[model samples]
Target: MPDETLVDVWGLAPAVLVIMVGGLALGLVVAAVDRAVVSGEAGRAVVEPLLAGARGLVEQRRTTLAPDRLLWRIGCAAVPTLALLSLAVVPVGGRTLWSTSADLVWFNAMEALLWAAVWLVGWGPNAVHALTGGYRFLAQGLAYELPLMFALITAGLAAGSLRTTDVVAAQEGLWFVVTMPVAFVVFVAGAAAFAFWGPFAAPAAADIAGGVTSELSGVDRLLVDLGRAVFLGAAAAMAVALFLGGDAGPWLPGPLWFLLKTLAVVTALVWAGRRVPVLRPDRTVEVGWMVLVPLTLLQALAVAVLVLNGFYA
Candidate 1:
């Protein structure tokens, strides 16, 4: 094993290695904290997960009849993989691993992969509940995708660039959250859908017998669980970058500030996830098309008008 590698992999740059390990660790810790807070057993809550993981490690993997083994494997692993890739573009202070002009688009696209991943996982299982869970995720994308895009584009339009770093720069003095509260709210809702958290968890809800994941177990199940946490954490990190003025706080280093903001967003999402009522999959489509679409569109147009008049300038 290499002494300097986060995952015993060879040839990763120090920065990339740090971000990879740090991001995963951050997601895990936040998730444990959220679970503890929600269950009213804050003490030893963190340690409980370690024991749970040990149990999962020893559990047997289950299989179903006529399963698409390849797709099932790929889908099970892809969630966290995509999420880590998405996190690469998220700024920790003034630095990012691969900051590009297309970061906003990249972030959106990566999050969008949840649809395919979840569906594949469901379809691969060839079971009724699993397939239904996958279908619910696809339905979720339809509901949240457009509003998510417009909300993100609102930031890009204001900054006049699609770069995540640029969005942060544009928020130096005035965070977009102040001017585009509607967009911010929509962004959070969209993020929740992607994470299948909060009211958007119909796909895997009790009504569906645990839905898409009803068949998953062992390492496969662990990956999906951690991936969801990381996806939510990534969304929260992006919210900090795109709306809360990334790393612009006083009296703290950029990474520390970024961490603080990310934690705040994660806390909010977790709280909302527990408090919000789950929407039926059918109702989700209706609301996404009828309500969120028009609202986010209007928000985008309003942002366009403001940008055209040099409002943020």
Candidate 2:
């Protein structure tokens, strides 16, 4: 791996292709894992997601009366767009598509934008169920977003830089997960919440007729679901970079090790998410503010203290 940070060796076009194709592929993997976990049928897991995508491609799109066509379309498109965009700063093969001094902030910004995009999806349809879902997502975002930020900041604080590569490099000797496990847990949980996935899926829960997805069908539905899976995979990869020590295994090459770790994280997320019952948005918000906010803050403070003592030095 190169020692220099933010190597732009792969130009813009290639980077975009990598992020697009790689993200979609990872999203499929997430779907498969989730299916296997829930159905206890490994074979079905392999076939279901592909079949679902094909069906989505061929199915007719459903539309509600009095829909805001423009916002609905934009919101649908933005879900996957933002997911790929967020990956620009994530290091792969010891390099990122694009790197900034505040790579962590860049990632966080994309997630924040996703919060709005989801609300738009819920609001665009002009249906009571969809609008309710949108509001639910908004409420959910209020609860989880801050702790997520603190978790990201804790990694940056330990690295003494906001760059993703720097965070990985800082973990050369000790993975941040060892000392900042709370941040790791919160970060992954936040990712699941932001994606409206698993236990944090109140925004799209079935009791409200699929919530934000109530008014969507065909490709629109496909896009939102695809975006959620990809975002979860991206978060797992980012978690690897931030806490598990990006590509730091001994014998295998860096990229392969990174792939392996990412797969493990994805599997763990899906397996665990399946077992926990879906949480109500109101209760989730309460926990986020009352329990998670303080826990992540203390996690950040502890990392800061460790950094001051040159524990990372």
Candidate 3:
């Protein structure tokens, strides 16, 4: 919100582009690692998927009956766009571009766009499977998204500021994960949900015949998948910044510490994907409302109490 700390408007677009490419690449690697674990394949599984995605560069786009090509394309485009946007506010160590006083709010809003982007992708196809997938994402969003927002709020409250740099600085003495374990856990669950990874992947699952992606092919499909991975990476990076004492360590540079922490969180999520069972779409709602929402609310309240009592100070 403060002009002194905001990203330069002229430099913002270019920074977003550069970060998007790097983030997307890192996201693919994290996803590849996770995929290999889940499929019982070699660690080199990233190779085959890379080749397949490259082939998509030349693969022809497929169409569904009565499809709205414009809306569908917008949906495809939005996936990576939103992923790129998420990193704009978050810092790498203490360095960042496009940050603001309300960066936490900005990040959350960009992520909320996932629901719209996903639903549009599903709905534009005009098929039973795709439509159902779109609806499923909406349901999933309602369930997981609220708690995610609350978790971010809890962090913001603890820091006494909504900016990410402040959040990182607040963990100078101790990490938020130690003080707010419930919120951290809920936030991790929300990250998996944001990427629609295992245990929260109903919208894109095989049971619904690949759900929203049933009608997708070629590079559009590649981008869509990569976008999901990129989103997961961004969430991991934010978790590092929020809960893991961003860029704080003995030997490593700040950026290296940040990178290491992000990878650790992403790896944990990938491992969870291998071990956790998928929650049915119906059950997702029940758990989200009955379990996640109340838990995050209590987390925030607890942080508020601690903050008021100078526990963090």
Candidate 4:
């Protein structure tokens, strides 16, 4: 409720805490939605995630011979750590934790770090399946990463600044989605791909024996799974911030509006993504290069023209 438009350096600690807690809460929401969709039991959605977390807390760690313990633990911890770090540049209530001139780049950098973290997770287990899964993730990344970059860059181009707050402000007259719908769709789909959720889950597919998570157990498993969910949730919030005019709804308090829009995005993403059959990693690459790359580039070009014509003004 405090003026979110003002950057409060003194309140930075609390802001970080809030983002962490809220991010985790959103993760839970994402889990619940996916559960409900998969099982067709609305009641189980809320109860199952909590029960799973509780079970994970007490479960014994699964061990493998010759595993890279240091890298494994570091990779597990970094999943959620990088997700939270990416949120630092996102405007929770019209103010970011740190105001950087290139907030968009900061967020993208965290995502790139996450790519390495996930590969490390796959390699640390030393199991053939785990390594395969890790490599699959890398392959999928090669497919989705460029289109995702263009999607983010498209938003930054329209705003004429890489700062997220400025991007949100530029939507005062028209949400970028109107001019850049392909970027919006590609952006959200890219989030699911990077998180390995729904259709883009080839890296963690059953064919590979749970893939990167094949050897994980107890707290390690929990961290990786929780990290995936949190990353998806954060991406949904970002989609809203980038394309839906963050906190710009009529008559509602800004933070509340932002929260509502974010929840809607997370729910919709889960519901829609769940129905698509998971693609093989190779085919995912085909679609990424053959379909998405060209589409997103064209979307960016159109936006650039709009920017040049002063349509935003």
Candidates' lDDT values, in order? 0.82, 0.91, 0.84, 0.89
Give me the overall lDDT of model 2: 0.91
- The order by descending TM-score is 2, 4, 3, 1
State the weakest 10-residue window (summed lDDT) of model 4: 1-10
Error of 1 at 167 (Å): 0.6
Which pairs of residues have clashing backbones in candidate 4? none
lDDT by residue (1-313, candidate 3, tens digit) is 4433324643766766667777877777777877788778876778866876788798999888889889899999899888878887767757566666788998998888888899999989899888898988888888888899999999999999998988988999999999899888888889888788888888888888998988899978987888888888888888889998889888879988888888888888888776877788788899899988998998999899999999889
Candidate with the greatest TM-score versus the true structure: 2
Question: Which sections of candidate 1 miss by over 4 Å?
Answer: 1-12
Q: Could you give me the TM-score of model 4 versus the true structure?
A: 0.96
Error of 3 at 229 (Å): 0.4
How good is model 1 by TM-score? 0.93
> What is the C-alpha lDDT profile of model 4 across 109-223, one tens digit per residue?
9888988999989999899999999999999999999999999999999999899988998899988889999999999999999999999998899999999999988999999
Error of 2 at 308 (Å): 0.7
Candidate 3 Cα errors over 4 Å, as ranges? 1-14
- Runs of candidate 4 with Cα error greater than 4 angstroms are 1-10
Clashes of 1: 0
Task: List per-candidate RMSD values in Å.
Answer: 4.4, 1.7, 2.0, 2.2
Query: Candidates' TM-scores?
Result: 0.93, 0.97, 0.94, 0.96
Residue 32 in model 4: shift from native, Å? Answer: 0.9
Question: Clash number for every model?
Answer: 0, 0, 1, 0
Per-residue lDDT tens digits for candidate 2, residues 102-122, read 899999999999988998899
Question: What lDDT score goes with residue 243 in model 3?
Answer: 90
| Least accurate 10 contiguous residues by lDDT in model 1 | 1-10
